[model samples]
Target: MLFTDLARSLPATIPFVGPEALERRMGVKFRARLGANESVFGPSPMVLEAMAEAARESWAYGDPEQYELKRAIADHHGIGMENIAIGEGIDGLLGHLVHLAAVPGDRVVTSYGAYPTFNYHVAGHGARLDFVPYRADDHEDPEALAARARDVRPKLLYFANPDNPTGSVHDAATIGRLIDAVPEETILVLDEAYSDLAPDGSLPPISLMRPNLLRFRTFSKAYGMAGVRVAYVVGEPAAIAQFDKVRNHFGVSRMAQAGALAALADQDHLRATIIRIAHAREELAAIARRANMTPLPSATNFVAIDCGGNGDYARTLLAAVLKRGVFIRMPGVEPLDRMIRVSVGTPDDLALFEDALMGAIAEVGRPTAT
Candidate 1:
């Protein structure tokens, strides 16, 4: 009973603890479920109907090629179908890409305290991680990242546009500059999980001209298909074709494909959901302000509120909220970890959050005067 060296070194714990697991541990249901950044609004009605229709065909395996969904995605993004690669989710796709690009001992560059899932995948493949501190202004410093890439000449560089935990976003101009600075041999993995909620001009336009850059998008956020787990990557045809060498052929389920296709077709539903999410973000920010906390401006479906203290104080607040049955999360590192992240939800959900948060604050005692 021996495990591979790589598997043996990896921690036995799951990276994310879902809300259900937490509920089971605490022996109570959460009054406000805002953690995990899921779309509480749920999927579009059209998507639901499409999934129901596809349910009858669930006995059949999905098209291994993923032709229809890929074409829909390509047309929506104004890209060629050959340039797209579909997968279970961005998480699954990331693992495959890291395996393809990085060999053991190769360097993989990412911002300190960025997406842990990417780091997890890189480590699983025995790649060395090179972390650059996040910018003081809260955005990813493209110049700093570029400098590290140049110095280390890492095989892969990963970043999320509207960064998780902090919800800070880098503009298109900044991203373009980083692209120009990266070495030709290095693969730039841009995780745009929150792209749909981003403000106009926030993301770089689709440009397959760059051979080294790969951008990932998901139906999990604004489209409200997280359970469906539909995500895709856009890059040069050569880069996309490489996925065929390693990806799970029938990984994308028929139900998921149908739901995603219907989701994509209903532009109105997507637009309405984005608008609602934007409003929820603002409402959450206002709630933070009234509570004397600072809510960082976000381009995502969640808001990170500066808890007006250190990581310990944030944890205390988190625990208090949990006691009140409101589920939320905070960063795992210093500086950024001083804030707790709350996902946008429906009005009733927000009401529960507000009540639970106020109750939690009361239970934790008032902030001390400096």
Candidate 2:
């Protein structure tokens, strides 16, 4: 077998160990799938119908340009079709962007405990990564990160508003400052996967664009189309055009395009899901409090509950919780690893989490005071 020097140098393992994989390993199916930040509420009725309709036409390839879906997304964001580029998901787009931007030994910057998938892409592309720690309050520090960018001038710098692992967020003004802080040479990859579920005015206006700024949006989160696999990046035409150079031409399927179009067309359904998520987030926080854990303030659909100890204690608790058949997740790094990340789900799903949490605590006991 032959592989590139890069491929041979890298670890054979992948980052994700999904619930199905866990079930196979542990020999028990999870009762609640809350780890992956998927919307248990599911997609809108219209989106389902559109996907079903499109599935019947599966013999034909989807438009390579993703013309109509791109048009709908453009109209939704008040941007031109030229400004958007569609891909399999944010994950796919991240991989392509890394490919476009990085050479061997290029540097990429991101928050220490931010999205692992982005870091994975950067590493896979043979780029060195520089991580800035989250702020004292658990938010990604734009100022510190910008300073790092100014110093390092990495090929790419990533910032996710309503950041993952913590569900912390910054207002539009802060985001604008982040955009401005990027050095001319670096591409700021702004991930807005949770924007639809964020506080009103938390996101900068969609009119915002820059030559070195690429903002990613997805139908996976608020649209509940994770399985459908449609996401897009918005940037100046020149930057967005880079995807066309290397992207899988027909990666976004007909069903995905149709479902995303229907999802966007039904804003009411999206709004209702946001509300449901907000309510569930509160319930998750309350569950943490009842269990004597500290729930971080969240602007996203998921809540991060501080387990009141070090990473080891949190790991033990997470394992006990998993053994209870509740599928949840935690950061793999220190500091942030002390918090277990729980995605918003239906009441019943959260109730299962609550039971799992309480039982896990009973089984594992509280973390020893440090």
Candidate 3:
């Protein structure tokens, strides 16, 4: 088959093999599906109704300009419509952003193990990837990443607040410092997928904008719309316009647009979901502690439980938990891998996980020597 040299060189892989794929392979259904950071709390009831309405009108193509969705998003955030650009999801938008800001062999900097999907896109485009280690507290170190970006002067800098896998967060002041630290020539890719659930002061106002900064958000997390495949980016008009040059005009599905618009409108439902997530997060943390594991403080909808060992130990814990019909995931690299990353779930789901975790610990014991 004909292919670019980059395609020929890249490894074929899915960044995460989702639970459905696991179910097919294992020939068993998970009782509590808590992996992949998806919200078990579900979308607002209004969103479901909107999606149903959109489904009946599926004969027409979605608006290429994403006009209404953009208007709604802008209004929700109290930002100018010109500052927003909607796409399939943060995953798809990141792909477009990488394409817009980087060229083959150009540099892209991120934490050593932040979101792998961003790295996947960078690699697919043949970009040289740079890494900065997380702070000892397991948080993405904005200062360290900025220093590396200054030294390397990469084309793109990737930072996720309320980070994935770790679920740790930095306050707005620290994030502002990192944004300021980024070189004028380097585009800062601020990923805020979990921003909806973040504490009040953890996020800067939506009015914040910079020519070199692009903040990515999604309906996938708190809105419980991961299956809907819709998200958007915020940046100055000039930078936002670049997405139009390379985006799939019909990529954001009609159903997704309708659902996200409705989700945005239902602020009360969103608040309720947020409260549910917060409560579930606490329950998950307490479960971790009762299992003799250390649960890191989380501002995101998931918790990272330290297994008090290394990657192998956590991996063992995760596998045992999975075999017991509670699907959870752990980070890929250490020392974060010493912790398992579990998405918040309902009472039933959390109970299943609690039993699974205790049983797994009983069977596996603890992390042994390398």
Candidate 4:
């Protein structure tokens, strides 16, 4: 076999078991798909129209330079086009970053139970991962991560603003402090996948730049184009250039570029979808409260509801919910595993989840003393 020693040594791990795979395995389709944090409301009408129009030209590959889409993104952020590097998605960009920076046995830093795909990429590139635990309040601890990065002097340090799983966010001031605190030699991989859903003061200014900082954004979340796989990383030109040496120049398809460009142009539709997601998030919190579980404050398009029990109890509840035909998920690692996460959806979709929750609770019952 020609596999690298790294490849042979690593486990066959997938970051997520998508809902479709779950349905096939369980032999039942989900009544409401809320597990993946996808925007059930979907992309704007303009995006659909653009993608459909671009489909006719799909025989030719998308522009390797991604000129028009990159220009639009640059104008949106008031940044130079030279600072942007587009990829299939944030996941693909992260993989490229890891490949560019880490060699076998190099270290990377991230929060425990943060985005697993980043960790998967690090492992695939044969880098060692050093994890800092989340704060007791469930937010990713930037200070702790900074300290760890300083200690390890890692090749990359990963932090997701408006973080996944917990859906907690830090204000711009605090995040700025973390950014400044990162070791000079370490690249701060700022994953802002949910930034569009965050409050006004939650994100630092787009003009903020450092040689060691790279911020990633995607059209998947607030723009409602997850399936399209279009996202980009913004950084100083030198650091951003590293991706070009390694990235698949045409990995982003023509339809994806057209759809994302259209999505960016339709700010009105984006605002409306954000408003809708906010309402649904509130409803989700209300449902959690009704079930006597605690919903964490979220700045993103999902809510994490504490099941008021341990990991086992949460797992049982999640299994019950899935069996009731609603797809949902929980964090895989400890402590954070006490909650089940659900994405924002329409009234009809959430109503299904609400019903599933009640039935699942009825079936599983609450955890009791040993």
TM-score of every model?
Answer: 0.97, 0.99, 0.98, 0.99
Write out the backbone clash pairs for model 4.
Answer: none
Tens digits of per-residue lDDT, candidate 3, 1-370, equal 7999899999999998998898889876899989978898889899999999999999999889989999999988899889999998899999999988888989999998789999999998999999888889999989889999999999999999889979999999999999999999999999999999999899988799999999999999999999999999999999999999999999888999999999999999889999999999999999988987799999999999998988888888898999899888888886778889889999999999999998999999977756
How do the residues 233-270 of candidate 1 rate in per-residue lDDT, one tens digit apiece?
A: 99999999999999999999999999999999999998
Which of the two candidates, 3 or 4, achieves a greater lDDT against the reference?
4
The better candidate by TM-score, 3 or 4, is 4
- Angstrom error at residue 269, model 1: 0.2
Ranked by lDDT from best down, the candidates are 4, 2, 3, 1
Tens digits of lDDT, candidate 4, 180-290: 999999999999999999999999998999999999999999999999999999999999999999999989999999999999999999999999999999999999999
Tens-place lDDT per residue, model 2, 1-370, is 5999998998866677989999999988899999999999899999999999999999999999999999999999889999999999999999999999999899999999899899899989999999999988999999999999999999999999979989988999999999998999999999999988888779998888889999999999989999889999999999989899999999999999999999999999998999999999999999999999999999887999999999999999999999999999999897799999999999999999999999999999999999
Candidate 3 global lDDT = 0.92
Please give the lDDT score at residue 359 for candidate 3: 91
| Number of the top lDDT candidate | 4
Candidate 3 or 2, higher TM-score: 2
